[model samples]
Target: MSGIRDAAAILAERLHAFRSLGDNCEFGFVQRYGGVEPSGLLRFSYTPLEDLIRGLRCGFSDFGVPGDLRLSVSAGGTYYCHSVAYNIWANTGHSAGSIAPEALLEREYGRLAHLKGKFLEDLADGTKILVRKTGRDDPESDFARLAEAVWAHGPSTLLRVTEAGPGWVPEPARRVADRLIAGTVRRFAPAEQAWEVDLEPWMHLVDGAYALARGAAPARLDADAFPEVLPLPGRLRRHVGRHREPALSAYTRAVDPAAVRGDAVHVFSSWVWIPEDFAGTRIFAAAGYARLGWRDADLSRRGCWQRVWAAGRLRPEAAREPVGLGMIGTRRDAFWSVGARFAEGPIPGEGPAPALRMPPARFPGRDLLGRLVPRFA
Candidate 1:
C-alpha cells in the first residue's frame, strides 16, 4: 500500500507540474500488456489521446501480436480535473471465449473497495479530494446496491454515473438512478452534481484539454477584431507598453514570433513581467489586452485556470509577425496583454490527435518510454 501511496504521490506531482506550466504542456501514456509506456511530451495542439491510441495500435502491430487487444487508455491535459493514478488492465493474445457482460460488470464492483483499502483509508486527515468510479453498469446490474458502499467513503465534491453497456437506459431512467444514488449518499454531495455519462472512460470527461490542443493562434487577430476596449490601470499600462519591466524579469523572458510553431501562447500583464519584442504598431493592443486579470487569478487560485482563450485568428503570413493578444483572465477582474507568436491553427472539437511519427530507426521504443504515467484527466 505504501507503493500505492508513492505512486499516487508521483501522479500528484506530475499533475501539479503539468498544471503549474499554465497552458503550455502536454502529458500522456500508452499501456501494452499491463506495461505502461510514457508517450514523451506529446506535441499535438489538442489530440494527445487520439495520437496515443494510434501509437498504441501501431506499436502493437509492430510487435506482431495476435487477436483483438483490449484497450484501456486515458489522455487529456491542462483543462481537466486532477485525477489520482488508476490502471486500466488490457491484454493481448488469443480469445478465451465470450464472457457475460454482467460478469464483467461485477469485476468493477470491487474497484472502490480496492481503492479505499489500499489508499483512501490511510490518507492524511482533512485532505480535500474527490474520487469517481465508472464502468458499464445499468439498473438491471443493480448498481444501486453499491450506493451505501460509495457513501461510506468520503470525497464530497460530486457524483458521476456512467452506464456504458447494452443495458443503458434513457435519460429519465438514468436520472432516476442518479436521484436514487444522490438521495442515498449521506454527505454534502449535491443533486446537481450527479451526472450521467456515455460508455467512454470517465477520464474522457476531460476532453476540453484535448479539444483545444490544436488551433490557430489566438493572437493573430484581424484589423477589425477589436470591437471593445476598456480602461487599464496605470501600473498595468506601463508594463505592456514596455515603459517599465517587472521587478522579477530575471525569471521570465520575451518570446520570439519567428520561433513560434505549434506552441500555445499566453499573455501576462507587464506589472508582473514585461513582454519584450512585440510589433511596434501593436503596442496599444498590449494595454487593451491588460483588461484580463489571468495572472492575478493564477496567483490566488494556483491551479484552477486551464481553458484556451478565444482571442482571434491571425493570417498565415502573420505567423511571422508579433501581435498583441488579450483575453479575459481566469479571474475576470481585468484583462492581460502580451505580444506572442501562435503558429498552430485552431481545431474544432476533438479534431484529430496528431499521428504518432516515431523516427524510422531501430531502437528500444518501449524501453525508452515504458513507465506508466498517471492519467489525471
Candidate 2:
C-alpha cells in the first residue's frame, strides 16, 4: 500500500474527535481489538482521503491547500504512530484531532516498532529535518522553498480548479477557509514562534563544502518540472502583465489563475511553516497583511517578509517580538500544547486554528477591499 493508505487505515480507527450537529455519520473515539484499550476521541472526517494523504506526504501548508486539514495520530500493528489528515478543509469546517502522550506509547496498540514518522508534526518536532526545510533558501525565507513545492505539486487539498468554471472561480473556497482560521491565532501559534535566516541554504552550502559534506547531495526541488501553470483568461493575463514585472508575470502564470484576475477579488490568506528551525528561541505568530506587515504591493516582490505577524503569546515564557513572515509551525508548539511528539496546528482545545490571510492585494486601494479581498488574489 502507499505510505498514506497504510497510515490512514491505522489512525483513522484510533483517533478521538467531536462531531457537530450536522447531517453526517457520528465520529469520535473508537474501541480497539484484542483487549486493547480505546484510542482517545477526536473530531475529523475521512472523506477526500486523497487530500490528507498529500498533506502528509508533501508537508503542504494548511494555507496552500484548497481545503483545510486536521492531523490525527494513526497507528497499526502496535508500533509506530503516523500523523494523518483526518479531515478535508472546506466550506463546512475542520475536525479537532489530537493524541495524548500516554496513549501514543501503549504496549499492545500504540508501541512504535521500527516505523519512522514523516508527518508535519515530525518535521515541526525536528524529526525529518531534511524534508521540512531541506536546508534550502529563497530570497524571503525557506518558506519560499515550501511555497514552490506546494505550487509545483498542486496537492488536491489546494488544487480545486474545476474543468469548466471561470479561470478563477475555484479560488473562493481557499479565501473562505482563510477567514475561518484567522480568529484562532494566539490560542494555537507557539508561545515562541520564530526562525532565523541570517544565512541559510548558504550556511548549509558552506557546511556541505566542509566536513561530512563530501559525497552528500544537496537538497532541492526540480526547477524544470514545476506543475503546469494554471491557464489564465486572456484579459487577466494582460491585466497582470500590465502591473507586474517580467519576473512577476512569469510567477503569476503559475499562481492559481483565478486569484490573479483583475476582476476577481482575493486575499492572500493563512500561511504557517511548522518545520522551521529557530535554533534556540520561542516566538508567537499569526499570518497577516494589514498595516503591520507587508502591504499588498509587495506580493510581487520576492525575498521580502510578506506574511508578517504580531509577536508573542500571553504566556511569559513565550518571548514577545515581531514575527517576520516565513514558514511557521513546529512540534515545539505541540510539545507544550499536547505533549505529543508532533502535531500540525495547536491541540484542539488549546486554541482554534484561525484562517489567517495576507492583507488583500491593493490595486488602487479601495474601501471594499474587506469584502472583495477573499474572492481574488
Candidate 3:
C-alpha cells in the first residue's frame, strides 16, 4: 500500500478501537473526480447510518458544483454529532449512482492517516521553530507560530494517544504526547501577551494538547496547574462611550450668547442646543446666521424668519441685509407676499435694494396673524 493509504489504515484501526470503548466518533470525506472537459462532482456527508437531508442541500451551495451532490449526517450516541463527506468528478461520464459513501470514506481515511503521521513526524523534529525563524520581526506572526507548535506537538499529541488506547499504542507516543501537552500549558498559558492575539486557534490547540497529555501520563497531569488568562480590561472600556447618551441639561447650560457673537458658536440648530425647549428662544431667533452644528450653511449671511402663530402673520426679519427666506419646501414656491422688514437701513456699498416678493394673500390663520400685528386689545 502507498504511504498515504497505509496511514489511513492505521487511523481507521485506531478509530475502530476508539468506538469499541463507547466513545462516539463520526467520520466524513470529500472527493473530486472529473476529466479535461466540464466535469461533475458529487458529495456525500453521512454519519454511521443516518443521512441528513438539509446537510446535502447546504453542501451543494457551499461547493458550487454543477452536478447534484448528496450529504448525510448521523449520531453515534444520545447527542447528534456531525460527519460530512463530499465527492467531485470531472468528465468521468460516470454517474455518482455507482459510488458508495462508505467505500469512499475507507479510501480517504487511509490517505488522511498517512498525512497526519507525516505531520506528527515533522512536528516531532521541531519544524515549527524553523517556521518561526522566517518571520521573527512581526510579534503577532511569531506568537501564532509558537501557539501552533504547542497545539500540534503538546497536548493534542497526548489526547490522540489516550483516545486511541492506553496500552494499545507504543510507549513513545504516550510519552511524547504527555510531555508536549504539559510543557505547553505550563509555559505558554501564563504569558499574558501571547494569549492575546488569535486566541481561538491557541485555545483549540491547548485543549487537544491537554487531552493528549493527560491520556499519556494520567498521573503527571496537574489539573490545577493550568493558568487562567483573562481578556484585556482596556478593550472593554473603549466601547462604553459609543453606546452612552449625551447629557442634555449640561449641554443646554453651556450655550453662551457672547460666545455665539464672537463666532465661537458657528453652527446652529435646535438639536445642537441640547434642551429642545430652547428651539425658538430669542438667542436662537436673533442669531439667524449663527452656525447650528447639525445643518450646513453660513449663518453670518442668511438670516431666518418665522411664521408667527399668535398674530396669524408671516413675520420676515432681515437682520443685516434683506435676506430672502427661500421657499419652504421647494424653491419654486415662493412665500414672499408677507411684508419683509429689515433690522437696519441699507449700509453703504450694498449691492441691490432688498426686495420682498410676497405670496398673493396674507398667511392663513387668526392666532398666527395676531402675533405679527401690533396688539390693540
Highest lDDT, which number? 1
Candidate 3: deviation at residue 255, Å?
A: 38
lDDT against the true structure, each candidate: 0.23, 0.22, 0.22
* Backbone-clash count (model 1): 19
Poorest 10 consecutive residues by lDDT, candidate 1: 26-35
Better of 2 and 3 by TM-score: 2
| Backbone N/Cα/C clashes per model | 19, 39, 62
RMSD of each: 23.5, 23.8, 29.4
Better-scoring candidate (lDDT), 1 or 2: 1
Q: Give stretches of model 3 more than 4 Å off.
A: 1-73, 76-99, 123-377
Q: Candidate 1 at 28: error in angstroms?
A: 7.3
The residue-by-residue lDDT of candidate 3 on 237-291, one tens digit each, is 0001111223111101222222222211111111111111112111111113321
Best by TM-score: 1
Global CA lDDT computed for model 1: 0.23
Estimate, for each residue in 1-377, the C-alpha lDDT of model 1 and write its tens digit: 23223221222222221110001121121011001232211211122222223322332122112222122222311112111122122221112334443443344334323532433332222122222223333343433333333334432222333333443322211123322311111121122222111111221222211122212121212211221221223221112222242221111232333443222222222212212222222111221121211112123221121112222222234323323333221221222222222222111111221222222122312434772111122
What's the TM for model 1? Answer: 0.20
TM-score of 2: 0.18
